[model samples]
Target: MSGAANPALLLGASLSAMAAALHLAIIVGGAPWYRCFGAGEGMAKLAQAGHWWPALLTLGIAFVLLVAAAYALGAGGWSAALRGLPGLRWVLLGITAVYLLRGLAPWPAMLLQPELRQPFWIWSTLICAGYGGVHALGLAQAWSRL
Candidate 1:
């Protein structure tokens, strides 16, 4: 399986890594779109609401995971890059679960609210489904190759 390099797997890993990097950059850059996630604008609200530390910690965790993902992508080599990552399959599995639930689960009441409907969850659902599916397929292909 080491020599059975699957380009799709490598490409999928690269895509996931790039997305993580972009997400981290957005958080660091104070992107307003992140307001919905308690990162930028929401941080102020969270601070006043007395839950700032937990939210901040969550964001920090996400950043760490993104960095780890990036490192895995780099370590994953040319022939079997995706398969090369030490524990990437588990990470991918976790990501897939989150995305699937976010995208396919019954819509939450908060997301149904008129004001937040447009940008909060609907778009995320679509993005998560598409992106998650791509990664899942990549994982599946890579696993099969392995």
Candidate 2:
């Protein structure tokens, strides 16, 4: 990895980390949080009923996001150990694709199922797109090192 940190990747890592933290906070905040975060009324109800599935699923997401953040950090040259991770390039590519795909999902949904659209969909799409854009730029900038 280069000695200099890639700012785009660093920002991507921060965004992922923040998302992971938000997921954890949602778990702590319970049903209200689920509802507030647009997790769906059913999920909120399940959480309110003390179902383990909701928290478990959310925790899994948080873990994945945290790992992605770490990978981004490593790829960005912020962490030497992480930079040595196996399949770093492929992993980063997958993460970038996932985010971009998610960001684009709402567009199709908006056309096919406008009734199901919500404010959350719009906001989440923008956020995911921004995250993916940052990751893509960083990945491109650091491609040779990885």
Candidate 3:
């Protein structure tokens, strides 16, 4: 069973890995690290008070993203188990759609808030859209092979 080499899976894996690392830092670095990410004073207070639910939630998301990336790669034939999974192509499609949706979802917020027009927000949104586009292309390539 061969499929086109899906670069999107690799991209997702790399991004997810970085996000997981950041999540780990957010979980352990406490108030100072959290503050650097523009989490606001309330979160800083929560971190200082040893309440890490918010970070935990982010960490959960980061972990799931990592898993999805791994699964994507595996389904691309990087692993036997992953290749054997049912509906691998459909799963890839879903992931692509999700990334695309997330990338576009910020547009409304950016339009409504002047602060979101800053370089940071623009760059982040660009990256998100780029990632989504890559994943979409990868999904199409892999599906063609299927």
Query: Which candidate comes out best when scored by TM-score?
Result: 2
Stronger candidate by lDDT (1 vs 3) = 3
User: Which 10 successive residues of model 3 have the least lDDT summed?
Assistant: 74-83
Reference-based lDDT, each prediction:
0.55, 0.93, 0.71
lDDT of 2 by residue, 10-110 (tens): 99999999999999999999999999999999999999999999999999999999999999998999988898878999999999999998888778878
Tens-place lDDT per residue, model 1, 36-130, is 44344556455445564634665676665464444334333343444455555576666656656766774665456666565546776776676
Worst 10 residues of 2 by lDDT: 108-117
Number of clashes in model 3? 0
lDDT of 1 at 70: 48
Estimate, for each residue in 1-146, the C-alpha lDDT of model 3 and write its tens digit: 58555676667656756767877787788888777765667877888898867677768877877766765776555666667666777776776777788778888999999878866566666776776787676666667564
Per-candidate TM equals: 0.60, 0.96, 0.80
The lDDT leader among the candidates is: 2
lDDT of 2: 0.93
Candidate 3, position 13, lDDT: 57
Model 1 global lDDT (CA atoms, 0 to 1): 0.55
Clash list (residue pairs), candidate 1: none
